[model samples]
Target chain A: MEPIKIKLDKSNELLTDLMPRKFGPQGRLWVGFLLLVIIIGAVAYYRQLKHGLVVTDMRDFTSWGIYISNFVFFVAISLVGSLVSAILKLTNVAWRTPLVRISEIIAVAAITFAAIIIIVDMGRPDRFWHLFVYGRIQSPILWDVIVITTYFVVSCLLLYIPLLPDIAVCRDTAPASPRWKKRFYTFLALNWKGTSKQYAIIHKSINVLAVLVVPLALGIHTVTSWLFATTYRAGWDSSNFGPYFVAGAFQAGCAGVIAVTFVLRNHYNLRKYITNKHFDNLGKLLVLLSLIYLYFNINEYLVPGYKMKTVDGEHLHSLFRGSYAPLFWSVQIFGMILPIIVLLFKKGRKPLPIFIVSILVVVGAWFKRFLIVIPTLLHPFIPIQNVPESWHHYVPTWEEWAITSASLAGALLIITIFVRLFPIISIWETTEEKMNATATQTGDQTQFYGA
Target chain B: MDEEQSNSRRSFIKTGLITGAIAAGGLGIMEVASQDTSKKKGDTVKLLSPDGKIVEVDSSEINPQIPDSLISTHNVREGVPGKKFVMVIDLAKCKNAGRCKSACSKMHYLPETRSYIKINKMQDSDKASPYWMPTPCFHCDNPPCVKVCPVGATFKLTDGIVGIDNDRCIGCRFCMVACPYSARVFNWDTEYQINVVRFKEIKEHAACSTHVTGTVEKCDFCPTKAAKNELPDCVQACPNGVFYFGDENEDVVSNGDETVRLSQLLKDKSGYRFLEDLGTKPRVYYLPPVDRQFPFKDVEPGTT
Candidate 1:
């Protein structure tokens, strides 16, 4: 009761400030727009289903189109959950409390869509159950399926465990206007009383989940890379793909966090919680990730470019100066190198500039996946032969465009709904951080949180 | 044939090949099935049913107009047991005559836009000669395509043919990407592309190998023909005898007219597999384009 009084006295301001609020007019508009996009995507997917994947421009030569790359993009960005929450949490970064929930939201949204887009790309989605019924352990795709499911589960638990206290807070503090919303909060709150035992369980569960997510995150992206690397395709035939894809994923994920954080910060007026300092720290982290990604990119492309073996040469040529050159170069310069260069300067790491840079990084990350999947497919070992002229080049039709756009929009919608339903930041953790800072002089916080 | 003429002929085949057995109340099926187009086919087909019984079927059963209960997945995965089929393409004799492509497409009921084989006009370098290398699915012993199939949809049969069970295929196209030879083709918009040519349903039957709407299709090495102890459509249809198909266990290959010892032909012609460095161990071997049969020329797939 004494500790309750202390927590109440300190966190009264934060509880009211951080409790979930109703969306503004702009927020409603945004949600409506996402719904519309999702509907359009649904229609497109329906058409694609009714007809076969031939609705896409994917032919024999370019059997995989933007749907695959978009799936890769979703997987890549989904890594943000582990990188921001798990890595930063384990490293004892005190500032990571405010960012973890957003990263998890993004991870959940993006990973959910990652699974969806893969099914959309499937030729026989009706037979998707066969992957489980008759799945081969030897196949890299099955490995991708296994790790992706595991990562999705881990990410959900990571997001949920940390959210229990917040859900309880929302349940207790929420205005009882909507009965179902209150019931949702109550059901998800899992009867949390915020006792020392409850807190202990929360902390212990979070630590385990955080530790478990790192490898699953890395494994998901690595297995995804193996889907290509296991093949002998010229561009995908490297041993470097696993680490390379992991590095690129981290880079894209970090940028995704920053970009979404910027939007949330502006839209929700969360500047006080997500400060300039947070942006600067994230920018610095993004720089490190970009440098690591650039190193792997060089290793992935340079050695092969240097050797220029016949197959790799044809593949690399298509990337370097061929049809894909402009995209490949732009993704390199803007996605990895530019972010590294821009974020190196302290001023550039500020909120506005870094937000713009993060947008560029995200867009470039998307096209980067395109460059990875498409150009290699076009340059298989056998010469492109007497197939129709249309098969020679892959141009994704509107159906593909609609579906991809919808998935992206669907992820945004998930995040938006999550923000509306709960506080975007970890309310309990943020209050704890505040209490820790304020009670340091009195040494009163140690007694309550020390366990 | 005119419209009425072709319709009447197809019904004649339907009754003569299958219903004629029912007309006789299921007695003496073999004799009744052989009443019409069977003798014209010149070879009788021996079908192994789902249960292990080798019964003689009329060759007229190969007709496309029959309602599509193509091949049993349970039966053909083991393939004509003890026979490891092989193909040898003599690069020397190829003049880019595309009868093989047409015959294969016609046999497989492929549309005008797609074929199982492609005659690649390959030039080694500026200094070396260009050759017409017709590439089909190699049915490699160490097949990259089969290894990557997540659902065991495409598999290597005991007869050295890589069979695709389209019923089981989830159509991820991972096999299509895994193949180095670029041999696999997706049935992209099967309903549309098939409607365009009005080709009959694919009856290639490399063990449940009918072209499902959203699955992978490829050169199944004409396992259906081989099941009947005949050369593949490409081998029989090649005008210049450039394509030789046979059995490796038998160590003999024939180009419809000439039978030769497989080892002797490879030894004399310096036969080798294409892209041998990749270690795919292809069932198809190639004798280099030397001592030219006709001058090397660039040719389209459906052109002379």
Candidate 2:
């Protein structure tokens, strides 16, 4: 209690600043918009279900369309949880405290939609249970299913264990919260008193999950990449797909975190908590990830471009100077190259500019996934035959657009609701970081405290 | 005693006639012929029933129904055992008449837009001569489609026929993507493509398993015809005798009219499988369009 009194004033300030707050009119409007988008998407999905996939423009040649691209986007974005939370946490990056919770929320939401969008792409979603009942171990798709589920569980544990103390804080500090919210906090807090034993268990559990999540995260995206790479198609036949996907996922994920943190900072008035330094550090991280992904992109495309094997030539020709060239170059330039160029500057790392760049990175990543799945399918080894000329090209139907938009909105809804219910930043950990920072600067050994 | 036995036999015949009339509306001429009491005909055939007892009946009385076992789901996946099926397409003979495509589509009840076989007009390069290439499922020995099928719905049978069980297919289209030949097509809106009457007709055929609405469909190499030692529809329907069907195990193939040794034909013609470098081990072979039966000048290179 003596040490508590010493740190009480600073800790209370953190609690007041970082605690979850009621949404204002603007927040309510945002939630309403997300809900409306989700409803529209659900209605589109219903039509797709009623009329089969024909409602979409997916034919034989362009069999896989934007739904698959959307699935890849969700999976790629979800990897942010593992990158920011598990990887940074293990590396002892102290600045990650405020970003970890947001990353985890994005991960959970994106992954949940990823699973949904894949089902949406299926010809027989009613038989989705067959994936489990009759799933074969040999298929890369089964491997993706297994690892994604594992990653989801590990990410949830990682998000939840650290949240126990915060939930307890909400329970004790906000008595005016709804009775259901109080009951929820009380149940989830697991009676956390912030005692030495509770803190020890929480720390140990988080460390284990953080360690476990790294391989699982890598496995999920790598398996997803293998879904394309394991096939004999031109664009997807590269051996570099696994690492290429993982690297691109990291880039997309970091961009996602930047965008989300920017929104949270402005909306919740959390500018002091998520300061410029976090953006600067994140900007640097984004550049490193983008550079790595750019390297992989070279490995993925350059060899095939050089070899120019007949089938690979057709696929590369399409991607380079054919129908898909515009998209391919745009994704490369905007998603990878431009982000690297812009974020290298200090001024570009500011919140507003970084947010704008992040949007580009994220949108480009979505189209990048589209380019990955569709172009390879169009340029099969054999020439396109007597099928309809339209089959040779793909244009997503209104149903496809609606459904894909819905999934994105669904992910945003999850993140928005999570921000409403829980502290977007980890309160207890941020306070600890503050206390340590204060002690170091003042050179006062007596002010140091341990949980 | 003889009179009593004859009277009882007559009564049995009368009861059978009444029941048969109820079941089949009216007896055919054959039934009347077999039941002719005026002629003392004594041609009897013995048949076994479900009870495992052999009963004697007149040969004309035996109107056979197709065995229930033939249409069972298990037989569809098992395929014709002890036979390794293969096909050889002579590119020189093909003029892209499109009869093979129509024959295949009609037999499989495929819609006008879809076909189990496609006559691709192929030319290796600007210098190379154009030829009509009728392509079907290769039924590859190391099938990429089978390897990637997550549910084991589409599988390679021991008889060298790659078959798809539409009931088991989840319609993920992974198999469609995995097929390098572009042989697979999804039943995107099968209900509209194939009507209800034709759907039931397809179900009765063991080889051409009726496609589900959201599942995959492809050329199954006409396993139903092959099981009966008959040529596949495409092989039989080709006007120029382009397609040759055979059992690789027997080493002989026939083009409806002409029979030749598979090994000898390949040796003489220098036949090769498509995309041999891919190592798919396709069952469909091609004889180079050398010594052309139809000149490359006749058909435009990219038209049909």
Candidate 3:
């Protein structure tokens, strides 16, 4: 980090505390577990490629199955990077220093898998190049492809640019490391000398990217919602879907960041950097997000429930009282309603309770996506007729479950490997914030910059 | 017209199966054992290929010309150049005989499990009487399926027909969800064994109707049949004259037995498109089931 005119002694301590480290036993087990799930998903995908989509239970009626829902989940979770690194950064949230890198990595991993799982859902993934070669601008799928690629590039840059100072710290301070790792950190450090001018440039670039990323993030998720909303299907035909999906995405992403932050804090002993105050702030943020998501949920469902058009009634009935009632009620109660209720109280905002609630939110968000995609498909304008009786219901085959679970595991694995490769919390940013706080509190003109 | 064509087809295949000089396309079992050899006499027959190249082959090797094979993929997607094809299903005459479904599967070489046409037993309300609705791809002017296709695999041609190019389709299934009619079906696992045989026997064609695994298929309005001024198989095979196929441009539609003016028929019978509020502007229209020929029987047609 360029130590500048500020304190260098505190930098040494923060650098030692925030540098990347090897995985402990639990971390190794977590990585191994994630790899195992990913391997099984690959094998299941092989079977799918060998047979056809027939291997899955998706037929003409429910053309999209769990793979699509999983895709939506990934897209939803990927929005956290924008929420933490961009939106929170722009607002100058005081406690957001340590949480930014974790959420950004989660966004990178989830968006990468979002792109992969969509290809997996394709009937002819081998012809994926045709999407680019013969792509029509009218289709939402092409829109998703373009925006998602843009978002991925922007997220990677957001993740990388902030890491240059930290990587330079690692390169200079990590003397016992292997040659390649030292070289790796050195190369990635981008010759950062932490000069006053370079700091200005970095701050300027971060600000520009931060502003650029928010709308792009909103557009990415809104375009994803359009993949369904643009169609004429009953549950999917709402004009309110764009904001509804974006709000729901923000909720999921917030919970995703909280859940990962809890694990990383406990596993890496990063309490000095992360602290309970960060979790408390995130818990309050999740509560706010969940309520906003609930507002959109009411708009999405209640307005249609009020009208109860003949076609939409069937879809609502299935969700409210029929086959899907159990899931619908459970996801609402446990995922959204319960988290909001629990996080509103002070004691519930503690690290452990909030972590459990965030897990529930993440799980609920996944099935909430399932509820969004599948119910509408089962109730089309035309009656299901002249087909086999089995087509009346959709149940994903084992291969579908395997592949979907693998995608989830694959995302976790990305975060896990990233932790080993670089610090999960930013070293330079945390040091700068700590020094600024000390300068303000103690009137320490000696350590203050431009003194 | 359908019976005549079926008989001619039966005799053609029967004759080819027995006689020594018979041919079954270019790749079929053609064990010609004629006493006079056309090669010795230097006899050659000039035939135009599907792509419009005139090639000369031995007289013995000339394939029986099926008009289906002659329409190239480019022709299939381009549609019948001059005609805006439309259909009117007379709900009054339909007894759910299911001849349309069978004929559609037969002509398209579809597997037994699936067909482009579905006979939906629909009742408008609790009080209204039920009728059989044979739904096909409506080929709407503002086709939802065409608009959602990411690769432009499905497109609305100038002739007002929506056609799908399986070769171009990436099998994303977005069009299937986009279509409110539920008309399209995926080739989840193709009838490849049967398609191999059909592809061989129809080798002289562009492999147009051969089903591809992981692609979407629907009622193409039989553009290949339209190329020859013949009705779609479903229209010609309906015994009760339940379906009327016509060119809207010509203002005429026929159900094999009777021909009528399009405007007059719709005006007189109060023919209407299904789900008219959706703004799809479907090409197919339906006449309300009034003055029915037979009672709305829920049982299978032949059982009673």
- List model 1 lDDT by residue over A52-135, tens digit each: 987899999999999999999999999999998899989998677789999998999999999999999999999999999999
Q: Evaluate candidate 3 and give its CAPRI docking class based on DockQ.
A: acceptable
Isolated chain A: TM-score per model?
A: 0.95, 0.95, 0.95
lDDT tens per residue, model 2, B71-159:
32225566565689999999989988877878877787766556878778788899998787888999999999999989989899877
DockQ of each: 0.53, 0.46, 0.44
**Candidate 3 at residue A157, lDDT?**
93
Best by lDDT: 3
Candidate 1 ranges with C-alpha deviation above 4 Å: A1-11, A442-451, B1-74, B192-208, B301-304
The candidate maximizing DockQ is 1
What lDDT score is found at residue A129 in candidate 1? 99
Flag the better candidate by DockQ, 1 or 3: 1
Model 3 stretches with alpha carbons more than 4 Å out: A1-11, A442-451, B1-74, B192-208, B300-304
- Name the 10 consecutive residues with the lowest summed lDDT in model 3 chain A: A442-451
Ranking by DockQ: 1, 2, 3
For every model shown, what is its TM-score relative to the native structure? 0.88, 0.88, 0.88
lDDT over C-alpha atoms for residue A161 of model 2: 91
